[model samples]
Target: MDSGLENIVAAETVLSDVDGQAGRLIIRGWPVETLAADKPYAAVLGLLWDGFFPELGDDAEIQAQLGRARAAAFALVGTFPMESGVVEALRTGWSLLNDSEAFDDAIAFPAAAAVFTAAAVRHGQGLPLIAPDPALSQAQDLLRMMRGTPASDAEARALDAYLATVSDHGLNASTFAARVIASTRAGLGSAVLGGISALKGPLHGGAPGPVLDMVDDIGTPDAAERWIDAALARGERLMGFGHRVYRVRDPRADALKAAVSKLPGTAGRIAFAEHIETVVLQRLARKYPNRRLETNVEFYTAVLLEALDIPREAFTAIFATGRVLGWIAHASEQIGEKRIVRPKSVYRGPVPEYA
Candidate 1:
């Protein structure tokens, strides 16, 4: 048996393709770079959910519906545990969703993510929760709700790009969890909760936070090379330099790096990060010539989110806001398959022998 199931092809989907060797990502026939540039999160949602939800008309309508969903989800924020961390409070918030219908859950899950994320962050800081505005786009409203003020056009666009960039990928850990629940005919909200639970694991959704830690530790571009060498000498894994799937540079890295560069007042940080990145690559190349260790999405994810003034504690929740769309789409596809996901196991322990 293949213990890790790395070689297994579990399901067929028209959602997205992840090419590790080539370091390319395509979602619904559009390259990730193309989709992320100038496309709003609502538009990406429209592309992923097309033909699945008949009620969703166009990008504008989907944005409006999502806005309404966020507003509806806001009323339930009182039930969310105020004392818990943002992710936990988000879990409580999502657990309270209506799971009776897929269509409703489809709209509600993503909407709730943004609302609960903002509310949880505000509650943790002892600040008042901001209500959702139904007319605002998802990215704009998410930032507005979090900060209790409107985001600038560039800030909103950068956030929208981030949301679209991470909307979907092939069956990674969380998306696979979502599909497994959906295969059992569980409601979309339940499936999405499974995704969230999986994402909560440090192995999946924990890298971006530490990228900032690494940057802070390095302190200066001139010190980065020596710092990286020392870290590697201690057998510490450079957090953002490698990915499980990608042998080449992650395409999403460039996408986010570009987004970060366009934002105002990020020039110094960008240069420092680029220096650190260059040193890391050079050292890795010299240390292990055979391995392809390049920058991954986590590196710039930290940069962009930090630039947006988002608290590092809320990184994964922000990620969930974007990735919930993928979870919903994959759950719907798995539900349509009408077959449960079941794999065989090899028995290694005690076996019975009959005469």
Candidate 2:
């Protein structure tokens, strides 16, 4: 009866592995650092969906197909009202993909799902959803659709880097949720939707947005230590500072910080964030000598996404957009094995009642 299933190995997988103690993530035989340095989002997708998706031409062909699918999804966003929350809008838009005759393939699933989710959320805000251009990369196309204009080369590359870095992580909550859905023989879209639902939880995807809120409240670097100290004194958890898994700083933090550095006007914000990080670390070390409250991925995720012009509320949805690739890959991996993901539970409640 391990509460929360700690240390449980519910399923076997060949997907990415999260090594918290080592502060490392290995994805499909490649270190995350190597992938971030050399590959684009399309290439990472290729690696993740290797065994599941049949040889889908090359990176160029996959990019083109995804662009076309995105445009198709954008056209359908108007059918669903945008007044609903982003998750609901995304879920509703995903149902529309079922109308397509060729929605079963793994390759097509992620491409269309990314498009539909982004467009649906944007459309719900009464914003115009841009059509995807086959000429552009997936990251650029996503930026174009979200911003209603083509992203600058730096912005495009920054986003590409972010998507590539975040495309997958070893069996995290969302990926596990995705695997559970896929084990039921549900389609890729269903699995991805399940992943998104899990990511929407505050403990997961909700942290990044609150990082921005925390920064805004602090107003200046000089005030960071005091603000964080007061919050801690009040029994409040500081957003973006600690991680559940990593004892040291999150490696993804460095990757995202580098990516955001390429965006215009981001240097100053990065510097300010660095100051906050320094203050928080110093304060935490002094206040709780035994605690390891290091900077986590959410710290820089907030800065990078904010620099990319993504609205605070849209952070999780955008996270879902990138992580959808990993979700699909895990789902396919689970389906290939054809096993149910039901884990055993230790019942501690009352015995059977008399009927």
Candidate 3:
């Protein structure tokens, strides 16, 4: 048996594909780069939820519905414990949602993620939560809710790109969890909770924050090479240099790098990150010529989020906001199949010898 199910082909999907060797990602029918650059978060949601949600209409309609959903989710901000971790608070808030298997219920997961995430951030900073504005786009409202003011168009656009870029990929760990729960005929809320639980794991959605920490630890462009080299010599894996998949550079990395480049007041950080990225790539090449260890999404994810003034601690929760769309779509697809995901396991434990 393949312990990790690496070679196993589970369920087929029309949502997204990941080509590890080519380092490509396709969502619905569009390449991640193209989709992320062109479409807003609402458009991507509309694309993903087209056949799943009967009421999901055009991008404008989806935006309006999502805006209302965010406002509805914000009503639970008072229930979340400020002492709990952001993700834990998010989970608590999500648990309170009605599991009616309705389109509005499914949409509430992403909406709640953004609302709870923004509220959690403010709570940590000893500030009151901002109410969601039903008029603003999801990305703009998310930023506004966090900062209590509107984000610049470029900033909101950069965040929109990020959300769209990471909306869906192949069946990742969290997505697989979501599909498994969905296969069991659980409601959308249950599936989303499964996905969020999986994302809380460090190996999955927790890398972006550490990438920022690594960069901050390096401090300067000139110091990057030495810091990385020393870390490598000590057998510490660089946080953002390699990926479990993606034989070459991650496509999302370039997408987010471009987004970061378009933002104002980020030139110095971007230049420093580029220099360090070059050094890391060169050093990695010299060290392991056989392995395709290259920059992954987390590298630029850190850069872009930091540029947006997002706290490092909230990076993973922010990831959930984007990825919740994929979870809902995949769950709906799995539900349509009407098949429970159950695989036989090999029992290597000692069998009882009974007479």
Predicted candidate 3 versus true structure: per-residue lDDT over 1-355, tens digit per residue:
8888868999899999999899999999999999878998889899998899888889888889888999899888887585777888888889999875799888888887889999999998999889999888989999998888899999999999999988987889999999999998879899999999999999999999888889889998879888999998999988888988789889999999999999988999999999989999999999998998999999999999998899888888899999989999999999999999999998889999999
Candidate 3 clashes between residue pairs 3 or more apart in a chain or in different chains: none
Candidate 2 per-residue lDDT over residues 1-355, each given as its tens digit = 6666648777666767778877887778887767766677677777777777666657777777776766666677678765767666766666666521122345555566556656765766777666677677877777777777778888877777677677888678888898898888877777877888888888888998889999999998878878988987897877888777788877888888888887889888999999988888887888789988898888988998888787776777777767888888888888878788888777789898898
Position 276, candidate 3: lDDT: 88
In order of appearance, the predictions have TM-scores of 0.98, 0.93, 0.98
C-alpha RMSD of candidate 1: 1.0
Which 10 residues in a row give candidate 3 its minimum summed lDDT? 77-86
lDDT of each: 0.90, 0.76, 0.90
Q: Please state the error at residue 139 of candidate 2 in Å.
A: 0.9
lDDT of 1 by residue, 1-355 (tens): 7776778899999999999999999999999888878689889888898878888778888888898899999999897586869888888899999874457667998898899999988988889989999999888898998999899989999998889888898999999999999899878888889998999899899888999999999998889988999998998888888888899999999999899889999999999999999999999999989999999988999999999989988999999988999999999999889899998887789889999
